[model samples]
Target: RLPIKWMSPESINFRRFTTASDVWMFAVCMWEILSYGKQPFFWLENKDVIGVLERGDRLPKPDLCPPILYTLMTRCWDYDPSERPKFKDL
Candidate 1:
């Protein structure tokens, strides 16, 4: 099963998915890669993910993730879909 942590707030709350949502998922995939496939939000239960996301929380940078990469990830998770970087910009 895919981790709930990869779902964007819009996708979770309103069933909206778009390229911006794909950007969010890509960020989570990057986090997993940085952490050697470690699951995102491993400490949280699946049911709690949406609430945490609604609260504007996001996964912290992995210890080994480069600053630039983490910055890109955070941008991808921006609450406003329009604020996310285009895939070409990544």
Candidate 2:
């Protein structure tokens, strides 16, 4: 299982970490786990993460990412946060 960066029922601690946000994080962790701890988006510029997130961007799927999981990741990072899926369903 992935580690919890923050925990709260109503709100996650980080400014951007909600249940949906955690699902996104989980998607990344799942990639890492499947790849034996491989780094993700390593080539992405440092600014890219923030730029994409602020502008509602998503990371490109890594080669090893399975189709089902990729679909879930896309859901997690939906441009409208409300459109993101709940962690419970994941």
Candidate 3:
């Protein structure tokens, strides 16, 4: 089973998976890497992550994360898949 923690909003909500979802997963993985493997949404249950996203919240930028890179991460988490940057553009 895929880790819900790494799932995109679409994948979690409507079972839609696409390149954009891949982008979201990549961003999350990057977040983990930058945070020294800290788990995303560590205090929330698997189901709660979706609600958090629907409420327009997201994983906070790490204190040490560069602003520009955090911008890219937010882009990957955009609610609308079409607005996310393609892998080629990252």
Candidate 4:
């Protein structure tokens, strides 16, 4: 099981997993890689992560992450799962 911080909000709220969930997690992984393994939402407790996401908050871009890459990450975290980009496009 993945940590809550890496989970898409829909999956956290509804226990529903889909290709979009994978896309969300992939973006978290990308953030990890770019941030040198830093945890996503490191400042928030696991239980609180969901509420933040529900409010449309996303992981802040790492200082060194490129703008284009950060844009991709944000797209992956879109609230509407259908709006998230597919892996092939990433």
How much does candidate 1 score in TM-score? 0.91
- Pick the winner on TM-score between candidates 3 and 4: 3
* Structural RMSD, model 2: 5.6
RMSD per candidate (Å) reads 1.4, 5.6, 0.9, 1.1
> For model 4, which pairs clash?
none
Candidate 4, residues 1-90: lDDT per residue as tens digits? 657999998899999999999999999999999999998899999889998998889988988999999999999999999999998887
* Model 1 Cα shift for residue 90 (angstroms): 1.0
Task: Give the top-scoring candidate (lDDT).
Answer: 4
The digit string of per-residue lDDT tens for model 2 on 5-64 reads: 211112222455566666666766776676676666565654344554556555667678
In order, the Cα lDDT scores of the candidates are 0.89, 0.58, 0.92, 0.93
How high is the lDDT of residue 24 in model 2? 64
Best TM-score among the predictions, by candidate number = 3
Ranking by lDDT: 4, 3, 1, 2
Give per-residue CA lDDT, model 1, range 1-90, as digits (tens): 745678988888787989999999999999899999888889999889998887889999999888988988999999999999999988
Which pairs clash in model 1? none
Model 4 misplaced regions, further than 4 Å: none
